[model samples]
Target: MDIEQLIALIDGFKQFPQIKRETTLFDIGSRGHFENPMTEVLSFFCNTTEVHGMNDLVISSIVSLIRQNAIYESLQYAQAHGKPQREVTTKNNKRIDLLLNSDEWVIAIESKVNHQQINPFDEYEAYVDSLIRTKKAVNKDNDLTDETEKQAVFVILSPDGKVDNVHLHPRWCGISFQQLVNEIKKRLQQHFFDAPFNKWYLVLKDFLLHLENLVNDEEQNSAQEEFVLTHLGEISQAWNLLKNTLQSVQQKAHTKLEQHPELNGILRSQKSSWFGLPTTILYSKDEMTEAVLFATGVPSVDIADDDPRNAGKHIFIQIHIQTDDEELELESIHESLANKAVNHWYSGGSKCFRWPVNELSIEGITKEFVSTFEAINNLSPLSLNK
Candidate 1:
């Protein structure tokens, strides 16, 4: 497909409703460490002893979803007894992301966010086994044979309910963030208004929203990848065409400025310092003062689709004055053109002005540059320099 056809397709896609992903508190506060904050929040909510006041509601909902019979039963048994801990150290000193421990049950949870399950599962398993052994020995000493036998549950938690290699650890169970989110949503729908602690309820709701956003973001990214891959050929052709068109328009503008009678004696073409676009420099006879005109929205296109200069359709002429003379009043020169120019600002000891032209044609660029140059030269200090 050609550039125009691709652009038309993009326009057609724009007719479809766009889903704007929300920026949750977790997104702002996580600061790029998603898993650590996620584990911390999960541990906070999972602890029944905490002030959340829902007691075992959150943990029980999560535990009930475990598919493995042994892990499910062990977690169920420990629902009231388990105390959630973050960064629990294993027997081999390897740290599990989150752990829930009780007298007779040990639940090891490894949290994953955009990372493979390459952790020391064996060490974590050993740690849980050691904990169970210690508890069993203590029970034996206390003659507590009537109590249920000790057990250990290993879980790998990720965005998707899948592990790297299920065969590697046959006993480990995989749970997804989406599953936990769904379970919590179901519980919240029934008990949200009746929740004892309104503050904690809001927090749980926010965390659930965060998880939902994460899952949605992943799904959208997958969709975007599929779309790009399916249209790679057309997209590649359009991109090359855009670059070529930008270069062509820039060359035409440069040629027009270089050949213009009004700017012939003073105009010199050079690469712009900003974005490396073509620049037309007009200097005074003494060469002590110069006006630099830069054309933007070319090789580097504007991101806004509605912008006239987007995709090299139009040109934005940016003019800035440079002078070696300290006595020249740059602000006064900028003030003179303020009414006629679209924008005027001061930066780095120079006064800059911007003018938007409707088209990228050579005549439009040349006409705008000559008028702006004259406006600057008409000022008292600049006119004296010329």
Candidate 2:
């Protein structure tokens, strides 16, 4: 059992036929402007002062998600002018993604995509401190801290709502993107005939649809699972072969990475992971931007197998560029690479560049990937010859 044998087994599954569909105006606008579509929609939701009647639903829905029953009750009595702020900056220079402030309660949210927080409770605690200071400044005799304290909710909003348990606080809570989408859907179904907020409702509804497309793919997953189960015998054989292929790939890749100029000096333990599958991480000398050359065994091909060049399952070399800089957006970089790269690369899920591995031999494939890694490491924004 080897990579060649696994490729032979996977070749039996035919690629699905392409379906032609017209793109919508929203799709076009989203492609260009909505670099972080979730963040854009979230800003709209938190903007209570922009649309009348809609804010009530948005505020109440958010409160419910945060699991603050006391805050939800308090919000019912608050004035209509109480607005939620988006991307609220703290005194410590930490940004809260969404900050909802009312006389009786305050909710601070930190948003994440695929990664966990580096410091889970730092910004949230700072926001609470700021809230307490504001309360004291408003009234010298106010016993907000010692007595009659208002509610302060801290939330981490993510795709899976998973965060570091070590850095969690007693007040901290988690909510998934799916839960938020469901809450919005429930609100949309309820009868609210406010004529003035019709436009806002439609926009919010469209955003919910976008979210649905992103997270809700249960039907597709179930179909894929069913297909695999139907061919269990064949897949079992393939899986056995894949295990051997993975070991062979890891061994060869480790040896090559140890001798390569740009990607040398990596320990075998640091390069390979065993949890999901044996995947190897390759990198250049400069690791400042979290960019890397990742080589992993890709098991299946659905639409990519249409071309003769993409017919086999092998080790995939992905060039991933990542940054924590708030000002430097990688959307433009991803777009540039997708358009200009010699290979066919797609960028949507996260900032990464990759092309199909057409080379049949392991040594040839590894060398090709190493050269590409070096090329990326040597690139500069000021280079006129690029």
Pick the TM-score winner. Answer: 1
Model 2: colliding residue pairs: none
Give one digit per residue, the lDDT tens place, for model 2 in 88-169: 6566666667665566566677777644476537766766766665654212322233213556667777666654573446
Candidate 1 residue 284 C-alpha distance from true site, Å: 8.6
Report residue 209 deviation for candidate 2 (angstroms).
2.2
Off by over 4 Å in 1: 1-17, 29-33, 67-77, 80-83, 136-148, 265-346, 350-386
> TM-score for each prediction?
0.72, 0.46
> How much is the lDDT of residue 104 in candidate 1?
48
RMSD of 2: 15.4
RMSD list, candidates in order: 6.6, 15.4
Judge candidate 2 against the unseen true structure and give its global Cα lDDT, from 0 to 1.
0.54
Query: What is the lDDT of every predicted structure here?
Result: 0.63, 0.54
